[model samples]
Target chain A: MDDKLMLMIPGPTPVPERVLQAMAKHPIGHRSADFSAIFAEVTENLKWLHQTKNDLLILAGSGTAAMEAGIINFLSTGDKVLVGTNGKFGERWGKVCAAYNLDVQYITAEWGKPLDPNEFKQALEADTAKDIKAVIITHSETSTGVINDLPTINQYIKAHGALSIVDTVTSLGACSVPIDEWGLDVVASGSQKGYMIPPGLGFVSVSEKAWKAYETANLPKFYFDLGPYRKNAAKNTTPFTPAINLIFALHAALGMMKQEGLETLFARHDRLRSATRAAVKAMGLPLFGPDECASPAVTAVMPTGVEAEKIRSIMRKKFDIALAGGQDSLKGKIFRIGHLGFVTDRDLLTAIAALEATLQELGHTGATPGAGVAAAGEVLNR
Target chain B: MDDKLMLMIPGPTPVPERVLQAMAKHPIGHRSADFSAIFAEVTENLKWLHQTKNDLLILAGSGTAAMEAGIINFLSTGDKVLVGTNGKFGERWGKVCAAYNLDVQYITAEWGKPLDPNEFKQALEADTAKDIKAVIITHSETSTGVINDLPTINQYIKAHGALSIVDTVTSLGACSVPIDEWGLDVVASGSQKGYMIPPGLGFVSVSEKAWKAYETANLPKFYFDLGPYRKNAAKNTTPFTPAINLIFALHAALGMMKQEGLETLFARHDRLRSATRAAVKAMGLPLFGPDECASPAVTAVMPTGVEAEKIRSIMRKKFDIALAGGQDSLKGKIFRIGHLGFVTDRDLLTAIAALEATLQELGHTGATPGAGVAAAGEVLNR
Candidate 1:
């Protein structure tokens, strides 16, 4: 049981053996020509994944680091930016903007609810002076299992001529972002979520409009400075020492992702999301968020009979499947099941069956013992 | 030839098989209690490695990010600081300060020379008004392979009542830093150099004095912010999603380092440094820095008659060994041989013998065929 633990968390998700094997190889010099080839190839494939030809840069840090870089690199002190706050990550962007002395205007929604695009539209329309320099939105809120209407909100930002800084940490690989089609400006994500790799690397895609903002943006930055990254990226290298083994892991994982193709990747996540939602519904447990705004990355469940922490403990200790507990205000009220990255239909079914058993062990009078798996099977088979 | 490549670079020095195996294991959730145990163990071992009981923080970033965090967390805009500039990394710290709009007064030294402690002493003594807030020093200049006199220079900072922010990237594991005895305020390092791991994770050890400074320091930072790191570290966790696999590698590597003991680790590096220098000297290659200030991590050589790049190329193609070329202005004039981390006496002797063969193949008439290895053998055997 020492090595049999399964990861069902949103981040630090399950990685493939091939990816781990690639990462286990001895690291070559980061500055070597061979490393450059890998860098160039990774950069190209990253653009393909994002569905954008924007300048994609990699940094050795977390999603927070990437999102911080996304905001700080394009705005100066007192630059008015609209930040959407519904979940933990959205509020995080607001905090990042505040830390840099940006004037943050918040468009709020209750927890487990998506941000209403009409509010963003009204805000942008009322800003007749166009004081709003950027609109920051988290596409897939990992905390509450809510995916905001990024496309609709981004339309208003484009109409207002403001750059869009998006957090696609949980949405990029799980769903279709289509950066070029959506005209998203600055999109940030991390390796642990949808990249099917371990944490440590952050990816940011910058549009030309965002680069224009960077030209005049004044923030005290060195490590997260985007200019040097862009300059070094032109030569197919990083300005700082990269995590060489992680890059190797990325190279292998991206190769696998490419072989799977984008449609299949997104379709698999869609099926898993539906199956998870359907299975939870059949088990008589309350799903936290509305079905219309469910995230493909994770499902948040607010069960009435079984305690959230108890469910997570049993799932982890007995089933060896690690599920995520709620963060912040939602703690002890909800538990999350991550079906992101390297997860398959079989994994979803296994987790649902375990959950059904956990409910039974907790003495909950559910519909039936096998009903959860049957519901999940209905969606997965479809 | 494919998988037989040997790394002789300062950073990303050869990783141990056990460490790589540990990293290859499945990643667990960072927020899980199991990961918290690993985090606690790694933190304790990091403090032991630094010879300090100060708060040691691990971050998922590169060394530049760690050093930048070390600087930005304790000082505000226009805070006067003296930055030592002798080589690439020293100048890099200065650039970080400049980016943060610090009033930087640099202590002078040539590229391959150690920073003169007297210059710092004189400057600190002359600052009667105590305008200087902190003194930034790089303990080992990786570019020029020169080790600065941190103890002597830090005395001036102490007398001047200014905090010391030190970059111990190359010096931490190669030699004894003894942060507590030295009263160093903020010391930053990376995992790839002396930890016998690949890059991606950075470590920063902060003294109580630096924490007091942090309460008043106002620099806009979110990802590199030390306040949250300290707060989280107290709970045996990180502020952000950590590089879980890299942390596993660090766990394995630091365990090995502890088994070897501090004295043995430093002695091994010292022995390799001496042997590398002797071998380079015997092969008619001019050592770039003086013996008194030689860094135990890497040795730079300015070859005569035989070209520097040519030697590196042949060493790579023929022996499948990689050596670091000089950076910036020193490029094309010198090549560096790294004896840092997992390198042993046999690796040094092997590299020397390969160099002799390379010199002979290049038709250089300066020395006998086996003199280089002979000189290295004497030091290694001693």
Candidate 2:
């Protein structure tokens, strides 16, 4: 293990010192006026980060809780839903929905591939009764480092009259989600990924349609019930005790984001992605995702005949650089290098240089040690 | 809201700088060996903090998630369970169970009251077929600032061949839980409370009996399935991506706890509780819980006819001290002052002084200024 390795994984991404300072503060009373103010600011900031004016509820859980909350609160027993499956998170949505007894129709796509909008349209047309209550899709699938086309998917959901629940756990704060413009009903995100905070808090922004559904929907929930969360969230208090420290971190992270401005943040991510992608290509490695749909948050590299885990382990133990490996079925096929929030061009260069060394150590010929670093530097300079 | 108010809420106590620093450190790769080592340390430390050698799973949610995970994973829908509803957390157990469609039979006690062993026996007698899968109880209810008698309740669950799930959210590190020795089948706790960190992490330690039921029992779960958690927890990894930065805080917090020694930590809480209770009694104000069952974590003071929220607000805005007010049914009746983890005798004294000032500001002439503080000092000094 690299004792001083920097994390370039999708998330728990790098956190700024100020956010950590905010988290380190004493745990305030969740119901107290002080905390209520912090909570309110955080909720508002989360909405701002998503670029939406929807009522956002914070859950003291991982992004999965927000996803589960979106599912359980929207559907009752035997509800049918269409889940776009292309990566781990999308499959997880199906698994979570199945657990709730929801009849989920899986819309499959190959790993590192985007689901066709036409397929979704056909599926919706087939279900003339509109029995499908919600359309679940991931904005940025971290597993394959692919950004799905949400605007097209949401349009399809709109035509079909289904609630659109988008998992922006990796997209928010890293890329443009444009919650309102995209017509997303429910958008879920986590603090650790792009918000530059630790994990443990999940944010869900609910549109008016979803909020109205929350009022009447009953699926047996207390802690994760959206009704209480929505009602209490307006006043800047959670229905239950939140992870107060994380809220503080959120407050700090949002302040940092607000200062940087969303447009600048998006541009920064774009530049970093371009640089990383260029570096990988210069190293003569195959890129996992299509160039058009490649995620700015992370880049997936395919090294022929290489086990993804070994490369990641070597990156960690040798040069103290940590990267993410493929999940489930994609195991040993692709290794991901993240360039999300709090990541810099310098970080990208360091990762490429380390990868070059690790590749050489693994006897992968035809790769110059400095080629990747120089390519990354050129893009970063541009 | 006071800009620099000190929080005296139990569970979300003050965090030390080192813990915050640990949390603020740049994010690490969650899947890498470096993180795995940190994860392993936290898992081992959680076992130590929980005082159990059983299966311990760390979750990225509040104590409620841990509580829900234990119940939903071990009990199938329509299964019956006995819940002890002495305070808020116990009521939450009943609420969450009902949410999951559990046929819950709760032995109720008034808020601020503790459950009697005889009442538990009667509930067990009512379930003659041994149909009760588990008995859910709270070791410390943060709302009412009362500690339940876990030893007595566990004895009942054991005699009846039912698993015992204890919510130690506010009591785990503050007092002696002794999970294995006390016959607790499932023990749930959160980091913000006794672990002396900011919120966002819930932990559960499961015994053999709970695991056995978890294998066959079916309840809706995805983010909080104890099965996957148990399976992955063995390798110092969570089933899902955890609140990684919070784990960093937890590592620091647990390190501090270990340095203090569990015995010393418990004694500190005991001393603080004794001081606060003695001071409250010395002031001649009516206290909420029974004298014997008063939690060392917090002290609920009933200021009859003196509006609780008003005084709490004054305390926050003027004296820069934040205390907890009553919830829904108990609102305006009492205000709770917490003196749990990370709090010192000086902090208790400061809180007492602030309470006196707020009471005076609210025109409460019942108690003398500094009287409680002075009395508290005597107890703490002893």
Candidate 3:
């Protein structure tokens, strides 16, 4: 019972025992040939996972740090940039832009709604003068479990000759984000979400266009400076001291990911998403976001008969299952169940069964016993 | 021979097994109450190690990131600051200042020499206009194994009414910084050094004075922003997803350090430094920095009859020991032996004995066969 706290949150996902053991290995000097060999291999594997031919750099920070670096490195001050906001993460990117005194243009929607790609297209077309330098979008809004149409938005960015900066934090591993095909200029993600590792390391991929913009970008930066990272990365090194053991964990996790293959990995996540959503709906809980735009990483549930906090509390205290509550304004309104990163069909069924038992125990007349598990099993079987 | 690599580098120091095992534990949601409890405990212990009652914040970054945050969070653009440079890290702070458009004044010294406390005194005394907003100093220059006279230099900064922003990256846990006693405003370090953990977490301790400066200081930051971190720390949370596993490692390592007690911790480092210095001296290798200014964390040896890189290569290849070679202009001229963190007296003796064998094997006449080990033993035994 002590170490059995099942994580059903979007990030800080379950890690495999192999990856955990890899992290426990003694750290070697970052400058050594042994480390360089591992670093080079890990970098290549990360590129494979990201589906990018661009320079994928790793930083010793969270997803926010990677997102901030993506925003700051490729644009100068006062440059007009369109930022999409629907959730906490999307809105935070706008704040990052404003912090650097960028001329921010927001394209916002309701918290649980996805950003309209048409809004981006319209704003980008209006910038015929080409003053707009970049477009910041969150691919998956973690707070609301809404996945934005980044592919369509990025196409507009390409047409407008503006860099596309995206936070694919939760979407990167759970869904297909073919960076090269989409022509996304910048894509940022964190380790905990999809890498199947612990937090602390962030990954960022930069296309040629983003690197070109780097030449003229006038933002003042040091630790998050991408140029040195690119140069050092070429030599199979990092500009700063990296999280050594975390890198080891990533190396092992990426190896596992490569074995799973991208197609299977994405398919697994898609199935997990369907299963989690199906289970929640069968319990008579309203899904916070619509099916069309729901994230493949996590499913947000808005219970009618039961309290969201109560469900989370019971899940945690009774079943030892940790569910994430809504962040920001959505607080206590919805509870999110994450089935991303190292989660399996069996794990989804287990979570669903526990949820049904909890609902029944709470005397929720709308929900039937075993209905949630049956619904999840149907999706998993399919 | 495969997994037998021993790290004797300045960073990525030897991590204790307890810490590594702690890091290998499954990561929980950072927002969870369980995580919050661990975070609060970790924060308290971190303050104990920092020897400060100030607001100590941790970032998922390297030491450079911590130092940059310390610089940017307390000063505005074009704020006059004096930076001391005797080695690589010292020079990096100046570059960080320049990147931020800070009007920087330099206090310079040779790489192998300690910073003249009088130089800081002279600069502070000359600034009758109080134009200098802060003074950045590296307490232990990791690149050169030189420890600057921080106490003496800090007094001058106090006299000048300028904030003392110090980089204690390689010195914090190795020796006493006594942040409050010295009235130091900002002190930054990394987990890879004296914290006895594998890299990734950077820590910055801020005094009330630095927080006061934070009200007006604006350098345009997001991820490295310390205010939100301060606010979150009060609630036992971080502004963003932290390096969860690394925090676990820190928690374990801190517990060990607490058990050992601060006095023993500092004394152990002191003994290691003396033993390493004595061994290198008896081996007829010139110490890169003078004895009075040598760092407790690492020892740089300038061999007379052996190539530094060659020594490092042979040690790494044949004996599985990883030693650090000189950086920048001093490259290939010096090799450094780290004696910080989880390093023990026996480890030091093993390294010195191995070095003696290496010298003999390399046909170096400058060093006697058994002199290094004997010398190290004499000092270590005392």
Chain A of candidate 1 gets a TM-score of 0.99
lDDT of 2 by residue, B1-382 (tens): 5347687877578888788778777667676666799999988888887778998888888878888887888888899988988777788889898888889988888888888888998888777899998888888888898888789877877889998888888888888888878878988887777788877788888889888888888887888888888778777788787888888888998999999998899999999999888888766678988779988888898877578778887887788877887776888898888888889888888888777777777777777777888899999888
Ranking by DockQ: 3, 1, 2
Candidate 3, A80-131: lDDT as tens digits: 9889999999889989999999999899999999888898889989988999
Best by DockQ: 3
Best prediction by lDDT: 1
Q: Which ten residues in a row have the lowest lDDT in candidate 2 chain A?
A: A24-33
* Pairs that collide, model 3: none
lDDT of 2 by residue, A17-70 (tens): 787777767667676666798888888888888889888889988899898898
Give candidate 2 regions above 4 Å deviation: A1-3, A305-310, A360-363, A367-369, B1-4, B304-314, B353-371
TM-score of chain A of 3: 0.99
lDDT of 2 at B360: 71
Among incorrect, acceptable, medium and high, the docking class of model 2 is medium
In Å, residue B281's CA in model 2 sits off its true spot by 1.8
